[model samples]
Target: MRSFCLLAFVVALLLPTQSFAANRDQHIIVVSVDGLAAYLLNDPKAPLPTIRKLAKAGSVAEGGMKVSNPSVTWPNHSSVITGVRPEKHGVLANGVLVRGAIDVPTVVDPKRDQQDLIRVKTIIDAAHEVGLATAEINWPCMRGSKSLDDSFPDVPEQVIHMTPRLRQELVIDGILADETQPSFAANSVVGKDLIWTEAACHLIRQRKPNLLFVHLLNCDATHHLLGAQTPAGYTANAYADSCVAKMVAATKEAGIFDKTTFIILADHGFTSTPKAICPNVLLRQNELLTVTAGKMSDAKIHVFPEGGIGLVYCTNPATAAADREKFRDLMKDKEGVAEVIFPDRFTELGIPHPREYNQSPDAVLVAKDGYAVAGTPIGEEFVVANTESKTALGSHGFISSLDKMNAPLVLSGNGVRTGETLKSVENIDVAPTIAKLLGIEFPSADGKALNAALSK
Candidate 1:
């Protein structure tokens, strides 16, 4: 009996420990520069000193590719953190789909899911599971993330909350003092650059989370307001890059510089399209879209009325099949329309196409590189006036060259190989690499560990 008891105790001691562990003392900071291109790092013309330095010292993906459809902020951002596609994570677009279960339309309510509601283990969650702390500063869809040690949900104030006059009064009170600087008052967490810098710096100085995620949208906002190649867009890009430099400095000042691994990435690239194609106008010509007072608030347009698998959804499902056929035939008739995809083709490209929900648009249309589609009807051929407007400067949401696929993944510091490059990799691979760095289990992750690039 004594021998058996001793043997049992020895076996128990030899068993593997049941918790994830931080593989290194160095921290991992994931930064997203909205609409940033991979070339930004190597572009000497762009004055991004800190980013260029990191690129030179770290391993970088040739260019970061993104997921398809809605291809907007929330889904792609969620994909990098969660290691899943939009379909799997359920963030279809910047806007949420409303099936009329509630009295009001449901936007992407960040508060719906509690922390543990995330089924897939995020890099942060994996870090935490293995006993490493985490933090996020202004990353999208993070309003309800319970795993974060510190977070500020991107809540905007409405006219109902405070009038312009009242807003000034509140600003004087410093009730809305910027988190970074604590001196200025700004409307959104983003514009208060000094505040975010201060807040992130403070977190790094004090708590020192194992994984930190920061997203700065000022650049993308600038691009949306200015064209991609325009001076305004370039200036915004420079400003965003400077903010990144500040972050790198902060980590170093905190004395975690050597141990921390920093990664700079972008969600998607921007494009310049100056025309809007109104498919609804064509539907009107066919008597499919009935306009009341020349306003269309409730009616849906069969954007790709002729595609085999559809992209858009309308209240009237009965007309979809015939309408899809019509839209496809019309595009076929048009000279410049590049590609028209039905719902079926989206899946073939490895893009998620949900069959159970009406999340996708009607038939999808792809215009040439210089062309853009508008919500309103103009003519068979039309140009968006004021194409030079700030809002007309740059845009995205199309299928084209890798220039739109441009983004970067630069990893540096402890546990990561210095001065390396990941030849060709997918965005899905980020989660697993972080998991390996933190020594956590991400069993369901589709990406590899990228062990070849990092220290074992």
Candidate 2:
């Protein structure tokens, strides 16, 4: 009998852990507050009562979450949802980088569908595959997704781009005057955020989706316009808190608060910059690119700006080697230039190789902390002052390794460990963690489920 008991215990240990078992009835709401730095939670003056309460009740990444390279919105958000970096997910920027002819300038087009942007299976797709209902509001790379039961995509002309049913419901509920472009465009940034919050609450009460994703943009915009740690930035953070409170209230009203889990996080953090570095201006001055009518007509090289990082593309393949060498010489002693990252470093940084991906840049130019990358070939000056009245005072999209790029992450409610503090986490880990909470399989994810943060 003792031997049999021991055998049974060993078998149980070999079996799957209960902490990772599927919970089909469980609901998870992922809220991405753009530009909400991890440090803000520890700030005494920051207004984040609701988020702090959630952290106190559940697990928190005290050291913050490391984001993907470039540290931009679309790439990091895709990492959070797909459990992979930009290289695997195929999202190098906020949109698809369309490569034209050898002499033609490439463009980042944001009108592409979700199917065209994301290469990997998302957590939402996994949940929907197993008969789980899902919804997303203002979530990036979710435009025209069939997996979502309801969606208001974060794209140009959002109201018109939203699912037909969602548009009709919003109109019927008096949240929108009509589905016209002009009507939706009339609302201010804050007003649009309120609409999104209301839509989220309505979905919680009505559809009760098994998984829901919400993204708030006010803090990010505020940071860009007024800079981080400013009074306006605090107000924007407070407003985001209010939005979360409303969603929490909706969950309680729907009688699912006890069974629901809330994962609040951000894509990347923000930093203030005193100067903007225009590498394209330098290229034009060197005659590497030609400007016509204040716009780049043709180029041997072009630099695509991603906030504090610039993607240097050799538009002319024939002169690629020479152009790169020339670019290095010109930028070697340039102020505000931090590092010139080549293809050799792509693998380590989770960036795609130029040979494998057409959108990949030949070289990456990272800016110093107090400078931002700008793509303006027509500008006479290579470096210009960043002012509130002209350019944005703050920006992100630095290399993810920078400490200032760390974002916040808090997991609360059902299936989560209580009063736990994690030293650090990765944005890629979020998807698998959410999948484990729902008891779903996400085998293709590059990141493992954060078991320590889950309750037994």
Candidate 3:
């Protein structure tokens, strides 16, 4: 009997530890607040009290989430979901990148076209693979992204894209409705945020998807319209918090509150730009550019502005190498030009090279701290002052490393370590952390799981 007992003990010790496995029953809800600043989370006097509660309950990153290079909307949002950089995911900007030859943003292109460009696995894909139901409520790169639907197959029907173009049908105020006759007009900030929140709340109640991703961009729009501290911005923040409170109530009402984990974060921060610089006009002054009918009809190179950064695409491939060198030389010491990022510098920053894809730019022009890159056509001035007499001018899409550009990262519940503050974390780390919490895998993720923020 003693010999048998000894053998059983040895066999048990060799087996895999059950503690390493994730709590499959635990649910994860990610609420993306589009332009939340890191200082807002750190500030004890900021208007956001609910966010502070969640931060204290679990953990908050003291260093905030450093977003992808350029720190634009879609790219960083894509990174948060893919656990990879912009280069790996193939979404370098919010507007669709013309992968054919233009190598620039096509603002009018369909979201599905944008979706098809994503290359790697996302948390949604991993969740679906493990038989977990997932829903995307206004989250970027999920509507018709091949990475999500190709792996999941049932993703399209599960999304509620509240934007004016892809608005879904909903029953608001207990009445059937669509964007055409929205109970809340889809264009307004309230409409965009509230409609999405209502739709997401409905999904959580009815579908009960194990993973629900909700993006609220009201604060972003408000900040752009009235600046961060205006009454409208505060109103937007309050409504966003109320949305969270609603979801929390729903989880408890459904008896899933204790099993649910809530993660609230933002894509990038907002800052004011003193001027909008048009670099293409400078090329025209040098006679290197030609504009016919207010467009770059006969130009050797085209400049696409992205807030505080601009990408210059060489129109002539034969002279591409020479054009890059010439453009870099011409732009040196130019007003508002911070650093002319050449192709060689791209790889070091994890930007995809032009040789690998048609969408890659030859050189990216970074702006000075108080400047933004203007999408000015041929006739516009080289630099225009940012007039604050009209709409408030808060902006982003700058390099994420800037102190003011750091976005918030608040976490709570599930396996999160209570009252802990991590020193550093990037938006790329979010996907893998979600995957780890769900006991899933995203093999192509560039960021490691945030082990420091999790409880053993």
Each candidate: RMSD to true structure? 5.9, 5.3, 5.8
Clashes of each: 28, 1, 0
Instruction: Supply the TM-score for candidate 3.
Output: 0.85
Off by over 4 Å in 3: 1-22, 99-110, 113-115, 145-169, 172-176, 179-186, 378-380, 388-392
Model 2 C-alpha lDDT per residue in residues 284-384, reported as the tens digit of each score: 88888899998899988888888889998898777777787778888997889998888888998898998899889988998999899888876678788
Per-residue CA lDDT of model 3 for 118-217, tens digit only, reads 7777888777766676777777766654333211111233223333222433544431254343344434767667767776676667666678888887
Worst 10 residues of 3 by lDDT: 149-158
Q: lDDT tens digits, residues 205-270, model 1?
A: 767878888777777777666665567767877887788877788887888888888878887777
Poorest stretch of ten by lDDT in candidate 2:
15-24
- When 2 and 3 are scored with TM-score, the better candidate is 2
Give the TM-score ranking, best first: 2, 3, 1
Which of 1 and 3 is the better model by lDDT? 3
Local lDDT at 125 for model 3: 74
lDDT of each: 0.60, 0.88, 0.72
- Measured against the true structure, the TM-scores of the candidates, in listed sequence, are 0.81, 0.94, 0.85
